[model samples]
Target: MRRAAKADDNQPVIVKSFRQLGWTVAHTHMIGRGFPDTVVSKQLPSGLKFTAVIEIKDGAKPKSSQALTPDEVVWREAWQGEYKIINSIEAVLEYHDWVMKKF
Candidate 1:
């Protein structure tokens, strides 16, 4: 299996890919909102706002042998807006598409 990516590595990759596609993105922690991994502002070419909280993680699927990590599960459950769990570029683009369609 591929090794998991550290936040240091994954964060920039996610940001760069989405920003290049024209989304306004930020690392959530940097904004003093200690919640998601990234915050994305989905916009139309005409600049309408479609925003959501996003969480990114690079890991194997959660193992049945172990219980959910409390902190991770808490954030996952408590998020109050459109949210997605993404691990690959396809998934990110899928999310952007879904946001555009929904909001």
Candidate 2:
């Protein structure tokens, strides 16, 4: 049987940070089966809204603890879309900056 989904220790902080930055965040951890943990959307200055999926890991944890599960690897490989793995608030800001530049 499949196990319950667990959010990384930093997930709440990341989600809150994203929301504070004016992005809409949806928690997707309950979806399980290697699906990303969150989906975030924001409207850029150019008035184009974009959505992206993210897998969150706690940067403070050991590398082994942060490693993706086999199902996650499979999901990532099979999915063809804008997906990112973020482990720190800095990475979140970087992603925001990158997305802002695309418009």
Candidate 3:
């Protein structure tokens, strides 16, 4: 059987949405030893800036291979600040709005 292909393409989609919303997104997420998949940043109108880490996963499948590893859990448990494990573009947009209210 042909495995799901586009399922692994969610990362680019998330990145694009973040860019559309005026946030700077990077594919190299070196934070916490590269536990996250993407790094996102934005400067609000008030000159307030914030950085966030996102871990993208394909939640469309019940048994998707995007589950976090043990290392990721350990890092996430110790890290601080904005972080999220997103599965869809809508979730990314929703989180963006939620984070915007913080600054």
Candidate 4:
């Protein structure tokens, strides 16, 4: 379990780590409106841009019931983002590696 207050805290760590690896990343789940959890862009040395939106949740699983919730489902459908449920800072690091590989 985790405090809701810092639930999305993984956003910056992931962003910074990726940036160190030379990825251009932004927090874009907001699409503006202050909702973006993390938006990452990778501009290859070749000038191609790869953009990915990541939503980070700490210490909680995304309940199917919640996903079925009206607004949640809507965002899931429209955002094309990822729901990452992590329990610790280490999880965030590991998950970041996994997601990058996935992309």
Candidate 5:
């Protein structure tokens, strides 16, 4: 039997951070089947909005613990869109800044 999905320890904080930055976040962890944890979208200065799929992993965890599962690998390989595995608030902030600059 498949196990229930659990959010990483830092997931709530990360989702809050994204919201604070004006991004709309949709939690998708319960969707399972290797789907990413969240989908976040923001409107750029150019009036265009873009969305990205994010998989959250706690940075405090060991590297081995943070490794993606086999199902995740398969899903990622088949996905053809903006996707990232993010760990920590700093990384989230940095990514937001990068998006601000790029758009």
Candidate 6:
């Protein structure tokens, strides 16, 4: 048997790993279709909360279509401009680690 692979097949796998690391993860499930796939936040012991928006893509060839859409761009610009385009689980964890040091 064969399986079909699309651009966002890894989102659930990455979300599961993110949850294991103590982040409160949420799927945008954007019915209107103008946002990132996931949003997550974690709190430090020092009472600092770090939140991030992540857009996920499959680690496949021709990475062009995975780029952020125009509306997603608007959302990032309105925020702290800390948006991430992720294709791997490690990148997601690394992003959290990078945010951890800031708090």
Please report the candidate that would top lDDT against the real structure. 5
Question: Which ranges of candidate 2 are over 4 A from the true structure?
Answer: none
Candidate 2 structure quality by residue, lDDT tens digits, 1-103: 8788988889999998898888999999989999999999998888888998999999999989899999999999998888999999998998888888877
In candidate 1, what are the lDDT values of residues 1-103, reduced to their tens digit? 5343235345677778788778888776443223567878865765678777766655344535223346557776876677776665777788777766765
Q: Which candidate do you rate higher for TM-score, 1 or 6?
A: 6
Candidate 1, residue 3: Cα displacement in angstroms equals: 21
* TM-score of decoy 5: 0.96
Error of 2 at 26 (Å): 0.5
Please give the CA lDDT of all the candidate structures.
0.65, 0.92, 0.76, 0.52, 0.94, 0.73
Per-residue lDDT tens digits for candidate 3, residues 48-97, read 88898888787675654767768678878988978898888899889889
Q: Write the per-residue lDDT of candidate 6 for residues 25-50, one digit (tens) a residue.
A: 88873532456778878887789877
For model 4, which pairs clash? 26-39, 27-39, 29-36, 30-35, 30-36
Candidate 6 off by > 4 Å: 1-7
Q: Model 1, clash count?
A: 0
User: How many residue pairs clash in each candidate at the backbone level?
Assistant: 0, 0, 0, 5, 0, 0
Sort order, TM-score high to low: 5, 2, 3, 6, 1, 4
lDDT of 2: 0.92
RMSD in Å for all candidates: 6.2, 1.0, 5.2, 6.5, 0.7, 5.5
Give the range of the ten consecutive residues with the poorest summed lDDT in model 2. 94-103
Clash pairs, model 3 backbone: none
Candidate number with the higher TM-score (4 or 5): 5
Point out the worst 10-residue segment of candidate 4 by lDDT: 1-10
Q: Name the lDDT value of residue 23 in candidate 4.
A: 63
Query: Model 4, range 77-98, lDDT digits (tens) per residue?
Result: 6765455433345665686566
Q: Of the candidates shown, which would achieve the greatest TM-score relative to the real structure?
A: 5
**Estimated TM-score per prediction?**
0.69, 0.94, 0.79, 0.49, 0.96, 0.76
